[model samples]
Target chain A: MTTSIRLPKELKVRVSEAAGHAGISSHHFILQAIEEKTLKEELNTNFYEEAEKRYTQIIETGECVSWEEMRCYLESLQSVPNPIKPIARKLEFNVKN
Target chain B: MTTSIRLPKELKVRVSEAAGHAGISSHHFILQAIEEKTLKEELNTNFYEEAEKRYTQIIETGECVSWEEMRCYLESLQSVPNPIKPIARKLEFNVKN
Candidate 1:
């Protein structure tokens, strides 16, 4: 199938020059650009969605360890040849009601 | 400095259960989740921005090769021991004015 698009005289000049430098047809360059744009957008969208899913799970299960403890454990492991996984636990908040 | 947030009773129960399972404080779990969410979003944002930048350059320069030609060149390279970059060229459109 054939389609047509109108480019201003200035853009035409740029396209022609770019096509010449790339050693490819202006038609091919435009197509490649569109393809790449779509692919990247899709990938990024999917990545964010996956992150959200994980976040929901964490909220639902509340499974987590504090950064301070994790950091300390990691530091302690620096001296050991083989380090073991640090234990995780719930945060105790002193809620005043 | 310390900050406080209110979670519903149900959520609190979930967090405690999750914290117990993870062997870390509920506080840590929430922090880690937030950190991961933020990092992924930033990375994805940067990725899209980079893609847009490249696409803009492609448009400005009009430097591109057609998918058909690129695909053929890639296929041909499969049989070769050492492959060279295929030449690119501008597209010629039959414009009616």
Candidate 2:
């Protein structure tokens, strides 16, 4: 497909120079740049969405394992092939309600 | 410093249970979870900001190296101790204006 884009004179000079140095057409360079940018945006969106989902789940369940507990278990795995897994549980409070 | 947060009864139960399983206090677990989330968000922000800056530079300069050119150069580096760097340049058009 063909399309048109407007580049200021300065940009046109820059693109022409860059394309010459790279030994490829300006069209390919622009296409590659667009692809790189689009992919990164998609990846960023997915990362945030996944994090949000996990955040909500943690909030609703309140099921969490402390960093201290998990770290020790993880460290042990450095030496041991199959170390025991860390378990997550609830905390106690004084009040019934 | 100490702070207070309200968790629904069900979440309170879950937090207690999870903490028990992990052998840590509910407070520590919650704190760690919050820390983890905050760090990831900071990282995500930095990643996007860096990408945006690069994108703008490319647009203004129109100086880009094609993916095909770069990929081949990159692949060459896998076997050779060092490879020549790919150059970026501008493209030619029929019309002067």
Candidate 3:
């Protein structure tokens, strides 16, 4: 698709300076820059999506490693060459019923 | 000034996905992304320009600290509380007469 974007006066000057530095035309520089930002934003979106999925799963399943178990695993890193892996257990919430 | 850019089929789709994630219209997202990239590129150009200027000055002035002095200062970092600072001396090129 083809579309027009309005560039401010100062932004136009900056683009020209940047484009000259990179030995490319202002239009080419803008295109490349937009492509880069699009890819970066896509990666960020994917990261947050994955994180949200994991968080929802944790909430529903209540399957997570306890802080004590995690601490033990971390502390064993130096003393114990082969530390036992921490296992995820169902979380228990104390509800006042 | 307004200019039209033709986006490839795949890139257009990617842009839409990214724009959706950002909760913004594709045009707005493109504009924002382009501005971010332009600013980043301008900074990079400025950095290189500064480095180039410094390098040109170093060559023209021939004022630079010797590597040996630099190494001595680095080595003294642990032992000496106030290590003598390395002074810049006019670099002498051992050119054959």
Candidate 4:
């Protein structure tokens, strides 16, 4: 199918240059770029939505642990005099949760 | 410099496993992952805000072009009797915009 489009000039030059670099006609290059750009936008939209949902859940539940806290907790586990027992206990606790 | 935290058990095990897989002490692995996750979340928040602004602009201006339309337009350029001149003219037009 054929259609008319009115693109600003700079974009056309870019498409032409991209086509030259890729060893394809400008038409093919433009189509490919449009396809790739559209797919990326769609994927990003989904990712953002999912992340937003997870963020809201974290906020509501107050169950999300900060990275700093998690890090510090891990650090203390190492400094304990009987590190093996505590580490093992923590691992067992983690498995239960 | 130091703080106490209470994490559920499953996460602790996963961190330990990850640390083992990476050939690092669990303490170091947890610290690195925490740092990486924090940075990623911060970056993603900024990206989402920027993308939302751009999406709103496109909606407000009605200037967002569909991929299908763009693809078809590129295809038409190929079948044009005088393709080069039109492509050049369009590119110049784009530059002006």
lDDT of 4 by residue, A4-75 (tens): 234446545644554565577755544444334334544666688799997887667655655555676778
DockQ of every predicted complex: 0.01, 0.01, 0.44, 0.01
- Reference-based TM-score, model 4: 0.31
- Total clashes, candidate 4? 10
Better of 2 and 4 by TM-score: 2
lDDT string, candidate 4, B6-81, tens digits: 4336545654555555577655554443334334544666688799997887667655655555576678888876
Provide the lowest-lDDT 10-residue window in model 4 chain A: A84-93
For model 4, the docking class works out as incorrect
Q: What would the per-residue lDDT of candidate 3 be over residues A1-97, giving only the tens digit for each residue? A: 6767777778778778878887998888878877987899878988998999978988898898878889989999989999999987797866798
- Quantify how close model 1 is to the true structure by its C-alpha RMSD in Å: 23.7
Poorest 10 consecutive residues of model 2 chain A by lDDT?
A1-10
lDDT of 1 by residue, B1-97 (tens): 2223344465456555555555766556544443343345446666887999978876887776777777877887889766766654556656899
Off by over 4 Å in 3: A65-97, B62-97
i-RMS, each model, one decimal: 22.8, 22.8, 1.6, 23.6
**Cα lDDT of model 3 overall?**
0.83
Query: lDDT per prediction?
Result: 0.58, 0.60, 0.83, 0.51
Off by over 4 Å in 4: A1-3, A8-14, A65-97, B1-97
True contacts kept of each: 0.00, 0.00, 0.73, 0.00
In model 2, what lDDT does residue A79 have? Answer: 100
Distance from true location, Cα of B65 in model 2, Å:
2.3
Model 2 ranges off by over 4 Å: A1-97, B73-85, B91-97
Residues A1-97, candidate 1, lDDT per residue (tens digit)?
2323444465455544555555766555444443343345446666887999967866877765677777877897879767766654456756899
